[model samples]
Target chain A: MADEEKEQQKQGEMEELPVILQLRPVPAITPVEEQFLKKFRFLKAWESSMPTELFLTTYAQSVRVLLCHGGTPVTADTIRCLPSLQCVIATSAGLNHIDLTECRKRDIAIANAGDCYSENGADYAIGLLLDVLRQFSASDRYVRQGLWPVKGAYPLGSKLGGKQVGIVGLGHIGSEVAKRLVAFGCSISYNSRKKKPSVAFPFYSDVRDLAANSDALILCCGLTKETYHIINRDVLLALGEKGVIINIGRGAIIDEKELIQCLMQGEIGGAGLDVFENEPDVPKELLAMDNVVLSPHKAVLTPEAIVSLQDLLMANLEAFFSNKPLVSEVKDE
Target chain B: MADEEKEQQKQGEMEELPVILQLRPVPAITPVEEQFLKKFRFLKAWESSMPTELFLTTYAQSVRVLLCHGGTPVTADTIRCLPSLQCVIATSAGLNHIDLTECRKRDIAIANAGDCYSENGADYAIGLLLDVLRQFSASDRYVRQGLWPVKGAYPLGSKLGGKQVGIVGLGHIGSEVAKRLVAFGCSISYNSRKKKPSVAFPFYSDVRDLAANSDALILCCGLTKETYHIINRDVLLALGEKGVIINIGRGAIIDEKELIQCLMQGEIGGAGLDVFENEPDVPKELLAMDNVVLSPHKAVLTPEAIVSLQDLLMANLEAFFSNKPLVSEVKDE
Candidate 1:
C-alpha cells in the first residue's frame, strides 16, 4: 500500500512541472549562474516572443513564468492569455510597462530588481553634478576649438558648496545621491511617501515645497499613477532662476514639454537628464537647448550592477525550487 | 644774526627733499590714498620713460623712490645710473626682469606686489583641478561638434574621493588647493620648504615620493633658484600611469618639453596646465594632445581677485607713507 501511494505521488509531481518563457534577451550569464540553472530539471526555459497566443500555445500544459526586460508595455490581454502563468519577474527597477493590476487579480507573483542599480544611478548623478558645477564640458570645448584667446575672459563658475540639494524621493537611489551630495558640502532635504526616521535629512511633505527651497532638485522617485508628470510647469517655476534640475528617475515623472519650455524661457538655470519621456528619441526642442545636459539611459548598465543582478536572480530561483523561502518574494495580495 | 641762522636752517630743510620719478603710468587712486601720498612731498612722482638717458637725468635729481610698472628690463647699467634711487617699487611680481643684485649693491629697497596675486593663483589651481577631474572640456567638444552619439564611449572618469592629492608647494595657492580639495574627499599630502606645523596634511620629504604616492600632483611653489625645473621628466615618470599633473605654479618649475613628451608617451595619464614655459604662447604640440588640458595665464585675473589685489596694494601704499609696516613686505635676504 505504501509503494502504491508513492507511485501516485510521483505521477502528481510530474504533472505539476512549470515552464519558463524568456521574453527579452539578456546578456550572457557567468559560468557560476549557468551551473546553478542546470540543476532545475523540472523547469523548461524557452526564449520565445511575449505575445498572448504565442505564450499560451508555448506553455499549454505547465504553469508559466515569464522573464522580461525593457521595451513595449504589457497589456491585460497578454496577461490573461497565459492561463497557467503563475509568476512574472521584471529584471529592472521600473514596472510601469507591466500590467500589475491584471497580475494582481490573477493571483500571480510579481517581483522586480528594485535596488540593484541604485549605486550606479547615484554614481552617474554625481558625475553629472560635477560636470556642470566644474564647467568641465564647456572649458574642454573652448580649448578643442582653438578659440581660447590668450587673454580671453575666463568662465566664472560657482562652487557646489553651500548649495541646497533637494531630493524628490528617498528611495534607494535617492538616498545614495543624498549621501554623495553630503560629501560635496551640500545641505540635503527630501520628499518621500513618509518621513523615514532612520534618515537625518529634512523632509518636505510636498514636492513643490522641496523644489522652492532647493538650489538644485534631483528626481529619483518611481513612476506610478500619482507621480506621472508630477514635475510639471508649476514645480519648475517654483524652483526659480538659479535652480538646476537633475532627473535620473523614470522619464514619465517629468513633463517633457514643460521641461523644454522652462529651459527655453530660462525659468530654471539648467537641467541634466539621463532619461526622457520617450527615450531613444528625445524631443527636438530639448536637444536644441544649451542649458540642458543629456545622457542616454545607460546609467544603470554598468558591468558591476549587471553582475550583481544576475547573481541575485539566480539565487532567488534556487531558493524557490528548493522549497526554501525566496530571497526577494513578492506578495500576491 | 638770529634771523640769518633761521634762514639757513630753512634752506637746509629744503635741501633734504627726496626727488621721486614715476615710470610708466598708474591708475587713479582714491582720495584717501592720494592724500597719504601728498605727505611724501620729497617724492616728485614725475611720469617719464625709462630710456638710458632719461633714467640717468631722473636719478641725477636725487630721486629717492622709483615707481616702475613695465618697459625694458632694468640692467646693471640702468641700476648704476640710478645711484640716488634709494628704492624701486615694482607693481608686479617676479624680480627676474629687474637687476636685484645691482639694486642690492646700491642699497636700494626692492618691493613688489607678489602676494597680491596669491588668491588669484589659488583660484586658478582649483579651476584646473575641476577641469581635469570632471572632463568638462572634452564633453563640451563632443556636444558642440554635434558628434554626441546616442551612446558615445567617453573615457570612464573617476571622482576625487579616496585619492591621495600631493601638493608640490604648500605656499598660498597650494594651501588654497588643499582647502578646496577637502570638499572633494581627497586625502591631502604636500611637500614644502619645511613642514608646516599649522597645516593638518602629511608632508613628504621628497617630491618624487609624493608623486609616486599621489593620484594627482599639483605644482604651486614659486619659481626660484631652489625650485626651478623641480618637476622634471624623472618626476613625471615617477608619477606613473594613473597620475595627473596640474601646474598653476611658475612654468619654469616644470620642464615643458619633457612634460609634453611624458604626456605623449602616457607616462602620466593627463595634465591641466594654466602656465607654460612661454607666456601668451603655449606649445602647439601639447595643445594637439587629447590627454593634456590647457588654459592661458589669466587664472588670477578674475574681477573679484583683481579688485582685491588693487585694494591690498593701495592699503600697502597708505601704510608705507604713515610710517607703518607694509602689508606684504619682501625681505632682502
Candidate 2:
C-alpha cells in the first residue's frame, strides 16, 4: 500500500506489455487494432523520420513481434535487422510477402490470417465468376446505358449449373468455393501442389490437365516460385475457348501477357480477375472487354473479415509473447 | 413391295403427324424448334396475310396443340377458336401469358417448362444478388472507367455469410436459392402463398413480415392475380434501409413505381432486378445508381435451358397425343 510499492507495480505492468513493430501502416485500421494499441505499446516505423534501417536498429533490441500485411514485403534483410524478432504475424491468408526460409532458419514462428478471409474471398471469387459467366456486369451495363429497349434482348448468359469447375489450390478458400458451387449444381474438381488426401473431388497435379477438363478454372493458391506463371499459354489452350478463368489469388500466378493474348484472341471465353500483375494498373485492353470482370484486387476485403483479422493478429501476438502456441502457425514447406 | 404401294405408305405416315399451331414466331428459335418442324406439321399463322382471327379459324379446326413462348399470350378467344386443342405447352416457367381459367374451363391440359429453367433462374438470381450486395457490377464499372488508381480502394462490401435471406416462394427456384445461400452460411427463411409442408425454412404468409426479419429477399414466385404488386412500398419499408431485394420472378410482382421511389429515397438499400413492370423499359432513374444491378429480364436465358425447354415441350406434346399423363402438367388451382 506504500507509495514506493505502488510506483514499482505500475512500472512492472508497463514493462510487461510487449513491443510490437510494424514497418508500414495497415491499409485500414479497425477498432480491434486500436484495442491492441491500448493493450500493448507499438513501435510504428513509418511514423519516424529516421530511415527504416535506423528505425529498425533503434528498436531491434526490444522488438520481439512483427506485424505485416499482404502488400508489404517482410524480406530476409528486414528480418536480419531485427535481431530480437521471435515471431511474424501476417494479416493475409498468403504469406508470400514474408521470407519463410529466413523465418525457418532463425526458428521464428509464423502465423497467418488462416480461415478468416476464406468465406469472403470465396464469395467474391464466385461473385466474379458469376459476373463473367452470367454476364451480370455486362448485361447491367447494357441495361444502364439505355440499350434494353433499343437492343431488344441482351445476349444470353451461360448457366452455372452442371459446369465443371476446376479449383486451383484446394485450401480453405478453394474448399469454400467448391461448397458454394456444389449448391448451384456445379461439378467440382481441383489442381493443387499435392493431392489432398481428405478431398473427395478428382485432383490433378498439373494445372493444364485440370483446365482441359474444366469449363471454368478458379485460382486460389499462394504466390510462390512454383505457382508463378502456372496458368501460362498451355493452360489457357487446354482450357479452350469455352473456358473461363477466375483469378482471386495473387496475379503473377497467371502469366498476365499470355492471358491477355488468349483473351484477346478468344482462345479463352472470359475472365474475372480480382488481382493483376501490377496493383492499380490493369491492362487497358481489359477495360473494353465485355466478357471480362475486373476488380481492384479486393477479393479478401470486407469489414467482417477485417475485424476477424484484427482479432487473429492480436491472438497470435499474445500467444507469442506468453510463449504459448501460435493460433494459426504456417509451417515451412 | 411395289413402288406405288411404298409411296402410299410414306404419304400415310406424313399425314399421321399431328398439326401444331403457332400464334407468333418463337424468337431465337433453337434447333429444338427446327426438330419440332421436322417431326410435325406447323401451321405458321404469320405466313398468311390473313388476320390472326381468320388464321385461327382456318387452321384451328385441325390444330390439336398450342405452342407458345413467354411473350405470346394465349387468350380465351384463341383457345375457343381451337376446338380441337387438347393442350397448351409454354416454353417458359411462368404461365401468366396463358389463360389458365379458360384452359381449365375447356378441359385443355397445361404443361409449363417445369424445372428446366429453375436452376438457371436461381443461379442468375444469386448472381444479381451478389452483384448488388458486393457491388460487383459497380466495381467492375469503376475498374473499367479507370477510377481505381485515382480513388484508392472501393468501399468494403457486406459479406454474404451469416446474413438472413428470405425467399419469396419456396418453389423450385426459391428452394434452389435457399440451397445455394445455405452453402454460403446464410440463414434462410421464406414467404410463399401457403407454407410448404416439406420445406424446413421458416415461412411467413405475409411478405412484409419476411422482409422485416431478413437482410435480403429473393423473389422467385410466378406472377398471379393475388401475387401482383406483392412487394409494395410497405414491404420495401419493412425491409428497411439495409435490406436488398433480388427479383428473378416476373415484373409487377413488386410495384415498380413504389420500388423506384423507395430506391430513390433510400428507404431500401439496394435491388437486383431482372424483370420490370414494363420490361425492356427500365425506369431511367435506376440507370445511374450503383447500388442496383439491372439485368435485361434475363434470369432464365441459357442455351442449356433452351435445349431443355425444347425437350420438355416435345415430351408434353408427345404425351398429350398419346393420351398419357403430362410430364410437366400445371393444374388450375
Candidate 3:
C-alpha cells in the first residue's frame, strides 16, 4: 500500500512541472538559467516560424508566466496579446523595460531580481569610488604608458578614511555601500525621499544639503521624474572643488553636461561613473582626466549575483504556481 | 605679576624647543610640517654653502637629532660623521633607509613612522584588489577609449563575497585589510612567520599551502632575507590559473620575472601591484593586460596619513628631548 502511494506521488510530480514562456532569448543564459530550463519547459516565441502574434495566440494562450529581461520590452500590446499571462518575471533590477501601468491595469503580478544584485552592486560602487579617489585606474594608465619612470611619483590620492560619504538613496544597495565603507573608517550619511526610521545613519531630505556636507556623494537612487537631473549645477557647486561624485545609479540622475563642464574646468574634484547620460557616448574630454574613472554600466554583472537572480526567479515562479505569496513581488505604487 | 610669569614661561619654552638637522628637503611640506618647524629649528643641509661633509662637521657639532626620509639613506659613515647625533627620526615606515647596525652599535636611538601608514596602506591594498578582481581599471579604459558602444557589455567579474583570501604577514596593515574585507563577506586566512595566538583567522605555516587553498593572496609581509622572492613560481602555480595576487608590501617579495610569465601565460589569473620589483619601471608587457592593476608605489601617501606621520614624528622627537622613552623607537633585534 505504501509503494502504491509513493508511485501516485511520483506520477503527480512528473506530470505537474510548470511551464514558463520566453518572449525572446536572453543575451546569455548561464548555467543557472540552464538549470532552470531543465525544471521548466519554455515556449520560445522567437523560435517559432509563425509571427509573434500568432505564436502568442496559439502557444501563449495556455502559458500563465512570462520570463523577460532588459533587452525585451513587455509592452502593453504584447501584454494584450497574452490573454492567459498572469505574471511577468524580470531578470533585471530596473523595470523601465516593462510597461507598469498596463500590467497594473491588467491586474497581473510582477517580480523583479530583488536583493540578489544589492551586494555585488554595492561592492562595485565602492570599487569605483576607490578607483577615483585613489587614482588606481589613472595610475595604472600612467604606469602602462611608461610614464611612471618618466613622470616620477604619481600625485597623492585623497584618503577614504574619515571622509563624509553621502549616499543619495539609502535603499538596499545604498545601505550595503554604507556597511562596507564603514569598515574602512568612513562616516556615512544619506539623503533619500523619506526618512527611514529603522536606519541609524544621519538623513537629509534635500540632496543639495547632503552634497554641501559631504566630501563624496554616491548616487544609488532610482531613476524617476522627480530624481531625473537631480544632481544639477547647484548640487555640483555645493559639493565644491574638493568634492567627488560617484554614480552607480542611472545616468540622468546627474546632469551629465554640467558634470562634464565642472570636471573640465576644475569646478569639482573628480567623478567615478558606472552609468552615463549618453552611455557608450562618454564625453571625449573626460578621456584624458587623471581624476575621473569611467565604467560601462556593469556594477551588477557578477557570476554570483546572476546565480542568485536565477534562484529568486525560480522561487517566484514556484510560489506563483503553488498559489503562495510572490517571493519578490513588485507591487503597484 | 601674571604678565611677568607668562614672559618667564615663554622664555623657558623657547629655550626648550628642540633643534633637528634636516638631511634633505621633503617632497612637499604641508602646514603640519610647517607647524613642526615652528616648534623646532631645522638645520637645512642643502641651504648651507659648505660641502655636506664640511657642513656636518662645522654645524653638526651640537646637533643631536637628525631628520630624514626614505629617499635619503643615512649610511653608517654619515651617522659616524655626526659625533653628537643621539637620535634618528625617520619619516618613512621601512628602516632599510637608515643604518640600523650602526645605530644599534653606538646605542643611538631610532624612531620610525609607526601606525601612521597602516590605515591608508590597508585601504589601498583593498582598492587594488577590488580593481584587479572587478576589472575596474580595465573597464574604465574601455569606456574612456570609446569601446563600450562597440562592445556590448564587459565580461562579468567574480564576486568578492564567499571568496577565500589569504593574507601574508598578519601585521598591522594585514589585520586592517582583513577587517575591511570581512564586511564584503570574504573569508580570511593568513600566513606569517609565526601563528598569531589572538587572531581567529585560519593560519598556514607555508605560503605555498596558503596559495593552494586561497583564491587570492595578499602580500603584506616585510621584505627580508627569508621573505625575498617568497611568492615564487611554485606559489604562483599553486594559486593556479584562477588566483589573484595583491601586493601593498615591498617589491622583491615575489619573483617579478616569473610573475610576468605567469600573468602572460595565464598560469595565475591576475595581480594588483603597488610596489614592483623595479619600481617606476614596471614590465612594459603588463601594459596591455586588462587583468593587472599597477600603481606607482603610493599606498600610503594620503594627506591624512601624512598629518599623522608628522604628529608621530614630533612626539618621538619631543620624547627623546625630554629623556622620555621614544614613542615609536625601533629596538635592535
Q: Please tell me the TM-score of chain A for candidate 3.
A: 0.88
Each predicted complex: what DockQ? 0.15, 0.83, 0.73
Which candidate's lDDT is highest? Answer: 2
| Per-residue accuracy of model 3 over A1-333 as CA lDDT, tens digit each | 599999999767744667788889864354656677557777789998999988888876678999897658889988998888899988877776788888898899998778998998899989988888889999888888888888798888889989999999887799999999999999999998899999999999999999999999999887767789999999999999999999998899999999999998898999999988877688888888888998888897888887788778778888998999899897832
Candidate 3, Cα interface RMSD: 0.9
DockQ of 2: 0.83
lDDT of each: 0.68, 0.89, 0.87
Best-performing candidate as measured by DockQ? 2
Interface RMSD of each: 4.9, 0.7, 0.9
**Residue-by-residue lDDT tens digits, candidate 2, A1-333:** 999999999778867788888899775454556678667877789999999999999888998898887789999999999999999888888888888989989999889889999999999999998899899989999999899999789888798889999999988899999999999888999998798889999999889999999999999999988999999999999999999999999999999999999999999999999999988999998999999999988888888888888778877878887889999998843
lDDT of 2 at B138: 92
Off by over 4 Å in 1: A1-22, A27-127, A170-188, A196-202, A222-227, A250-253, A280-292, A297-333, B1-136, B143-165, B170-188, B196-202, B220-228, B248-253, B279-282, B285-333
Native-referenced Cα lDDT, model 3: 0.87
lDDT of 3 at B295: 89
- Model 3 spans with C-alpha error above 4 angstroms: A1-17, A28-34, A49-54, A57-60, B1-18, B28-34, B48-60
Model 1: residue B160 alpha-carbon error in angstroms: 4.8
Off by over 4 Å in 2: A1-16, B1-16, B28-30
